[model samples]
Target: MSSTLAEQRAEWRERIAGIGDTLRAESETNEDLRQLSPATEAALRSVNAFNLCSPEELGGVNAHPRLQTQVIADITSHDSSAGWCALIGAHESAWLASRLPDSSVERIFAHSDERWPVTCGSIAPEGEAEQVEGGWMVTGRWGWASGIHHSDFILSMSRITGQEPEPGKPPPLLCAAAPKADVVVEDTWHTLGMRGTGSTHYRYENVFVPDEMCLAGFERPPLRGGGWLARPTVTFLTAAGYGFPLGVAKRAVEEITRQATEHTRTGQRASISEQQHFQGDLGRCVALVEAMEGYGHHLFEELLAAPINSLEDAVRMDDRARAALRWAHQTAEDVVRTAHEHAGGPAVYSDNVLARLLRDIQTVSQHVIQTQSAYIRRGQHQLGIPVRPGL
Candidate 1:
């Protein structure tokens, strides 16, 4: 299965290479218009590129987490927006793997096989729920729901029906899985870059979610004895989310190297690749990429080998995983910056690939997952010190 998954990803890589230029062109226009292109959407669905993270048990080949990021990086080298959307959509299956019932999982595959790929979900606590006869009624708005335009189903998080809250406490987030009919997708994804991601806000109004359709992290029945596999879904989502942009940074470095070698600096007749200074800079970038990749793979392999076991165990693993995420983001940021600086002014021009790569890298790097402030807070909290706000 592993070999097959690798082979499949390789095939997808080749497909991306073949269509990368087209996707890039379309993506550029989409960025200009602040919307996604139909061709870009069709191409992704054509390749089933969004299914890369689906678990093997769900009639989808679940590739290794490390390899998944590698493929995403490859795609990002071609088009950042497509890579971001692809990874986001593909990761939807990973989050659903733990919570969705077999029937719903099958339905996902059934529709996916038909070529309607869905992505983006609301898992944060930002909704109201009321108890009903058979299930619960949930209504709320989830922002930053990327890939919703193409999604066939939308996952919204809402409070459990009849749930009580303390004076200052908000309701807990429950995973309310429902079809797109239950929510309205707003095309509000205007941003600096990665416009093709179609990350918009979604609203749910009086949506009825059956018991089987709802999944919550802080609430779930424990096994009679014990089972590590039944751990919370939040851990899985957090771990899988980092793969996309990490891949984008990897690709940015590659493109930067390619462009750096072909173009000469203002003062030099030879390409940057021929210069000692450029060589040194590129080498550092490569080393950072290598080290980040190694650490990310090591930590991810551990999680996959164990999956989720216990709350304490998951928490411990999350610490290491978060550390890996930080390294990946920092190294990626440094590498992209090096690439941009080493590539020079011409590479910064709109027509240059380095410029686009730079924009995409920057756009995705600004996400909360890669934010340095979050890392510091996590570290401080782990050290038994009070976490400073916005640290």
Candidate 2:
């Protein structure tokens, strides 16, 4: 890494670590309120955590993928929900900032002196957009709109109503960015884990998105920022996605290790740390997290370093990064489960960190990107079978 980049990474890591106590202190309240606590949000804003991936010209770090991943992992190590929100918020904002027309970008960043804008939206093409004179009228209810409660802009992916693709081509999709005031947030984010993300469903009914505020497709090259933004969006997103599970698993390991020192099983005489089984399990968990981190960082570095000259190249990078993420997710789930199981009765209590780690990991594992289909697709590719295009 360049000296400047290394220094940048160190600064971000320290900044995130500085807020660790605040995140931990507010975690329970955040869960109860189904969103980040005010203090937690303020701490994050103080460090510009939501703008890490945004363009440098727009008062953001414009961090590299590896650095961004580390930032997410570090933040997640303190609180998974906060980490999740940071990940989603940063990426969404950067996506819009990089793709939106100059007018929209200027307007969105106009208030950066007071507070940098945060964005939340769904990329799934569940909404429909009807073409009109200047822009499209969008109407749909998008689920899992994380950080929507605190977002300045809401984005939705929709299919253009009258556009049909040629044979073997995907349908034309448009992404519309609207002011948060233009959308209605539904209180439907009650969940098993990562509840503090406030990932509720949001509705856009006949919302007229101006032409300048929307992108024609999801995979267009960025109009601003460095080469990092030019890479396939899914590839870096996959890189960032692993941070939540990895951090949670690392936290699980830390919590269980600490508990092992003072925790004794109900029927056992020795402390949990003294037992061979507990020791071995904790050792395995630690190794799993370390390995996952190394693999993820290495894979992302390689993916970003390679030149993506064609669609095939982008798909190849996306597949590799995604496959690694899936493994990391499954491994993280394993680590958290093992830690919880061995932590015994205390791990079940709501106050216990292990309990929350377990729930967060499980919830994150259910994300569509972590599904088994990635594995199946990888297997098909290796077996000389025709795999579907794109991730």
Candidate 3:
């Protein structure tokens, strides 16, 4: 790694570490408010956490994918919602900077002198875009708009009206970016966990997105950035996806460990830590989390070294990256569950740290990318079975 990049990583590590206490302190408020507390948001902004994946030329850190994952993991170790928001915002910023036209990129990043812009959107083609004189008129509501509450620009994927694809091809999709003012953020974020992500519904009603502010499809090559951004979007995003679950699981393990030392269950003479059963469970959880982290790091290293010279190469890399993610998600969920279960009665309370960690990890495990179908597809690929594209 270049010295400059190494230095940037170190700086980011220190900055995120410094805010650990604040993130933890604000966790309750963030959950209660169903969004990040102002303090938490400001602390993250101060660290430039939301720009880690964006282009350096656009005044973003543009850290390596591994570094980005570590940053998110570290932040998530403190607060899962903060970590989720950071990852989503960083990825969206990178996508907009690398995929949108130069004019739109400049418009979004140029004027943000105080802080780099935060972008959040839904990638599902839930909206419709009709071609107009100067651009497309978008109208539809999209769910799971994570971090949309604080985004400066919101992107929505829409199908072009009256456009059809050839046989064996999918419908034509366009991604349109509109200023936050143009989008209506509906209060639909209430959920089982990860509430601070504010992943609510957002709608664009005939919102005019200029031609320059739209990208034809997600598979297009980056308009800017180094070789790292050239990988398929799935591979590029795989690393960041590891952070949320790992961080939350790590925190759960820590919380249980701390609880064991100080708290004893009713009718039990010894502290939780002194019990062989608890020790065994905690040891297994620790090992599982460590294994997940080590595997994720190894996968990223392999990805960096692997060449992607052809479509087949890209598909192979995507398969491995996504498969690793699915495994990590499952492992993390297991670790969190063990931790929560061993934490005993206190863990059932809403204010318990393990309770929150359990909820957050469970919510993350439900994400589309972490589903079991990914494993089936990877198995099919290995067995020479015909797997559908984009599975």
In order of appearance, the predictions have TM-scores of: 0.82, 0.96, 0.96
lDDT of 3 by residue, 1-391 (tens): 2467578668778888999999999999999989888999998898888877777788776677778778999999999999999999988888888888888777777765586778999989999999999999999999998888788889899888999998988999989888899999999887998988899999999999899988646666788876556678888888787887788878988899999898888999999999999999988998988888888877887897788787777777888788888888788889888888778899899999889888888888888887887788788889888655585
Q: Rank the candidates by lDDT, best first.
A: 2, 3, 1
Give the clashing pairs for model 2: none
The global C-alpha lDDT for each of the candidates, from Candidate 1 onward, is 0.66, 0.85, 0.85
Query: Is 1 or 3 the stronger prediction by lDDT?
Result: 3
Task: Give the higher-TM-score candidate: 1 or 2.
Answer: 2
Q: Residues 1-391, candidate 2, lDDT per residue (tens digit)? A: 2368788788878888899999999999899999888998898898888888888888877788778888889999999989999999998988888888899889889888589889989989999999898988999989999888888899999988988988988998889999999999999988988889899999999999989999546577788887566678778687667788888888988888899898888999999899998888888888898898898778878877899787767776677777888898889889988988988889889879989888888898888877887787778777877665665
Global fold similarity of model 3 (TM-score): 0.96
Candidate 2, TM-score vs. the true structure?
0.96
What alpha-carbon RMSD in Å does predicted model 1 have with respect to the real structure?
Answer: 4.2
lDDT of 2: 0.85
Which wins on lDDT, candidate 1 or candidate 2? Answer: 2
- Angstrom error at residue 84, model 1: 1.4
